[model samples]
Target: MSERVTPGHSGGLITLGTADALWAGLTNGSAVPTVSAACTCFPADVRAGYVLLGGRVVATVKAGGGQWGVPEMEVRRAAAELNVVKMDHGDLVRIGPFGGAPKQKQNDTAPLRWRQRIARELQELGDVERAAPSEGRLHHLAGIDWRVLVEETRDRTVRAWWLPRAVVRLLDAAEHAETRWLQAARTRQNSTAAAEPPSQRRQIRAAGGRQTTSPHSPTTAPRPYNGELKELLYSALSRKHGISRKVAEWMCAVCRTTPATVLDHCHEHGYVRAPVCQSCNTQERPDHLYSNDIRVASHYTRLFDTHNVDWLRHWHRCPGCRTRTTLPLPHLAAWTAYIACRSLRPTHRAPRGRKPCGVLRVSWTGSQNAPRSCLLTVTVDFCPSGEHRVLAQIPYREAAERFGTWLAETAPAVAAAAGPDRLDGLPTQPRPVIPDTNSDGQALF
Candidate 1:
């Protein structure tokens, strides 16, 4: 008969293959001694307060009641016993880019053992560096040079990873480790649920009936801004235009409903964009390559375009109307009609009928803090084909009067269409029909 295993008993000899089988059995919720047993015979670092199931190290239970997996030394020992070679820089590069996890097929390019090794090493390094352990930190530790791009207008520089292959290797390893941790947590949670009394289990089932959350469900709430992450966000906020913790509590700039709790920035360019919610922040993916597509183009292109444009400025709710009354088609149409009527030239009418100059484009320049007034810029594009020329600059009150008067005259129809408290239109001013070749335009708000 085979030797019976007991807690804290190392007298029973187990082969490497048997140890592997025991580890697999423990992972699959088998009746293993991993929970009760202790590695009293082994060294402190290798033992790490964790009970070795067979001869294999499991996880380290910290004094503070947290688990971070087996120690690095223990992992090295396992690797040596298994005859697994250490992954070098070339091997990491050969792993290639990680384009996110696949839905159907497995995307674990890195081995589980290697991932455990890297994660433990990263955790140890993070303890010394006084920063939270993250997959991105691997690049910094590897002495990999980041590509730095200068932003003259912001008086800042943005840095991004120079190599894609290295990024993939780090991400793959991180993904594998995170996946393993999540699986372990889930298994433990299920076991706890199973141990509960029938009445309690039924109550739990009834209470959780409405809850449709899964491990893959999108996070609804924003991540807590505490510890090292909070400090990092605060440092990044220094370069942003008008973002603060108070401002972040307001409505999201992207989704417009959820509270803006996350400080969003361009990952490729590294410049702060806007205050958005956690969901919006994750959803908005900027193109790493500055492509031609206007909708999903790179943030660098959008920022550069904003600087190059003449009339465009940062858009916000109008104090008078409590809505974005600058760039909607209906507002623009009403404004154009009103401007044409005002600038009508009855004597200079052509055979094809009068085309009163061109359309008048009204956009917000910026708000005056002291006097509490908005600067509305009116640019007129002359008939047929001409550039948008500066027409006039008026206060928020004047612009409100022009747009409101026109709406009141066309009452009921236009008024109802431009719904009350409407927050419509793109976040920026309307793009000029004629592109300004000259790049000497003033900086956007």
Candidate 2:
């Protein structure tokens, strides 16, 4: 008959060990006996090992055996069902799901092996909790599904199970080996990203293009980097009136709700005009390559012809804002209607540290500590035919009374339509803060 095998007893395998010294020691039973600490046999130089149960050696780890870690969750449930303390020896069994039963199992007098403990735990927890309960990466690495058969070799030996320091050393080595590669991959990705042009596209591709980082002052602190990116962004195109995409993006051509995403370019010169949002890029810009500006002056060549009394017969709309007044004069006329309502204002000044906004998000109440005020500015953009003259900015409120008096005398009907205290014309020459009355407070009229 074939030799009868004992649970965890490997007298036969001991003679066949690859190492001569280890084999000799096992053959003579001179091998230092040790214990299994789940993933590995601990206390080095030990050839024969015992798998313990409640302080007793129920089976040998054998001359040749597999190893694994006891998952934390399994240990807890098994201890609870087996009536063993969860923290004590609960994580001991780290050996694997062996292919088959041990030739014989040595059951401890306490009557609980890993299988009995886990089985009782599973039964008590019921199907829902027992099947594929929540587990982590470490649990997958250490715990195996198979259990060792324990009844074949029953014993009264008792020993507590704890992972020796040797096992911890082995785990640390494995972790260090894997982490090196993960860290290297992250560094390489950052290098590749730094090569691209700076764009404020920090949000994930799937996150609807929302910004990833915190926002700061649009002028002093631009988004995605800073004003430093402005020059480089349009260096290839044009730099005459270069404005950073960050500041320009805050305003759109059509509406302030959406941000400008593209640089508005001059079609004829292939130069950067201004930063414009995506909506204006597609909708606001004219289709034709030439005269593509949205301004009404470009489309209505008749207005540029000599200004005549008849020109006032047809009411015109302001090209910039489409604001029409009852003056019945050409919108491009030298005079502007004096309205009593609030006018467009600027919050730009040198001492205050705020520059003029190329594109503005007008509603935000800016820094409380800084000097802030909005003044109405009017431009009398009168250019001779065939000549393009940049209109000078004249303080509208400062000259309101003088301009209004001139309009009242020159165009009484236009002044009446403009409401009271309205300016229907500008003086041949400009002056700042010319009140309706002289220093004596008498009516200048």
Candidate 3:
């Protein structure tokens, strides 16, 4: 019969012979006790006693010298003394004082889950932000001011379960903040870059220490003259006016001397060949006596008025004679008026057809009432006799248009009449005349 014992049993200690027998039974697996099947049972007091005595348990089947084994009886005694039932081979044991499994912990698990979830959230947020346009004021916020949230929450510690959300928020904030900072830096850089001065900024000093505002300096541009007044005068006459330097020097020499006194003191008594003496002779001569004058018809001399009378000065020489002559005011006025009337006439002829002939002759015809009235005969040059004459005593202004019409009708014949006289003095050899043509190949007047 088995006797049940409590925790403080004095007979709990196993005898040495019984301990040896129990050790053999325990080592041979023949000491399967009848305690709770789920509990791990062993001869606790017997094992403790064997340990105190420095005895080692061994398998009975194995050969070993320090091999003390436990038997069934010793195991039962130990289990009963300790107030614990024996257990099967596969029973569980309690590690700590409370005799139950300590609470399982996963310290790293929560943080790992947080990191993964935050990473996924941050990735999604980045995709959304990246898809937005980078323009306008909102873009400015997205680029610059968003990073503050990230730095603030980066190292925040929270409950392990909340780690995922925390990390996501922190990363998003950090990304936004970083983008904002970079954008702000770029904006500042752009503002600085956009600032530029006007085209005409300031005067800069040249390599030679000269202050210049012009695009090109004197050294690179044309140099100005730097000389005395006399030298400047000489250079102006020679270089600017294309006069020979020797001629300028000779003029200066003559101006420097007193005319008569210098001439008398010189070896040549009166050197008329000298420009100074020649100039004096020219100045003394009367211009009218030195030049010849030609008489032009009074009718052809009625073209001028007071305002344009000065133009006659340019035609001082006669076309017949190369002699220079001046026209009286009346003659100038008359010639100008006559030319004006002639210019108003349009007598151009087409190239493909034969043109008509026309002529204006001022002959003294008989008329008692108007003695000054001349017979103005308009005749075709082809029929020079008065048979083809269109007689009319018209005023000068009215005659211009009539003459133009008549000339237009009879241009060919009229041109032929004047051709012989026009070519009489000219050389018989061919002279080149440049004809003007319009874009359409028509001759331009």
- TM-scores for all candidates? 0.23, 0.16, 0.14
Question: Per-residue CA lDDT of candidate 3, range 293-409, in tens?
Answer: 112222232123332222222122121111112122222222323342344322425586733334323222322123244222222222323245433334333333443343334
Clashes of each: 0, 13, 32
Pick the TM-score winner: 1
Which lDDT tens digits does candidate 2 get at residues 1-445? 2222234643323221222222222223211121122222211111222112121121122223543112222222322322321222221222212223243333222222333333333334444223453332111111111222111111263211122222222222222222222233334435545865557323212122211111110111112312222213234644545344243424333223333455543221222334433333333211111110112222122222332221222221111111122221112122321222114323345577954322211111111112143122232222223333322233333234444565455545644545433233322222111122111211110
Residue 224 local lDDT, model 1? 27
Point out the higher-scoring one by TM-score: 1 or 3.
1
By summed lDDT, the worst window of 10 consecutive residues in model 1 runs over 142-151
Candidate 2 deviant stretches above 4 angstroms: 1-249, 266-273, 287-445
Tens digits of per-residue lDDT for model 1, 379-436: 5544455444655665655655565554445343434434346343322333322211
Pick by lDDT: 2 or 3, better one: 2
Q: Any runs in candidate 1 off by more than 4 Å, and if so which?
A: 1-373, 376-392, 398-445
